[model samples]
Target: MKSTSTLLAPEEEFPTALSELPVLEIHVLHSRVCRQLDHEYLTDPAGAHPVTLDRHHELVAELDDRDAA
Candidate 1:
């Protein structure tokens, strides 16, 4: 598949591609990692941006729930 990143202008994006191994499952695996981190590690971790962390956790939860259904 052509990379969607190429649709962006050169200056607006960096080079990236879906790696060969398990490209189809990357989203599921990545979400599991984020959910683990959100629940187990990132709560008020020192020197981090609290607002950004909160937003990330919210997104992770939403995705996880959608996938679980």
Candidate 2:
């Protein structure tokens, strides 16, 4: 049998320093629940944890906060 890895096309990279992140649009670190179940079943189980929809927002908050400090 052969394996197939073509699900989504490759994404373009935007290289930027950490200090240039944006402000947050939402608050609270999620409910800290069931987040893993959907990922475990829906995505590549062996692959690294998939980034959530709001990951960029969260990262922006983190980076922007560090810059402010």
What RMSD, rounded to one decimal, does every model reach? 10.5, 10.7
lDDT of 1 by residue, 1-69 (tens): 233331222123221332432434445434443554454445545633444355345545555665686
In candidate 2, the residue pairs with backbone N, CA or C atoms under 3 Å apart (3 or more residues apart, or in different chains) clash, namely none
lDDT of 2: 0.36
| Model 2 CA deviation exceeding 4 Å by range | 1-10, 24-41, 49-68
Give the RMSD in angstroms, all C-alphas superposed, for model 2: 10.7
Give each model's clash number. 0, 0
> What tens digits encode model 2's per-residue C-alpha lDDT throughout 1-69?
111321211132222343443333122222121243244447765743444433444545665576688
Please list the residue runs of candidate 1 whose C-alpha ends up more than 4 Å from where it truly belongs after superposition: 1-46
How close is every model to the real structure, measured as TM-score?
Answer: 0.33, 0.28
Query: Global lDDT for candidate 1?
Result: 0.41
Candidate that scores best on TM-score: 1
**Model 2: residue 63 alpha-carbon error in angstroms:** 4.1
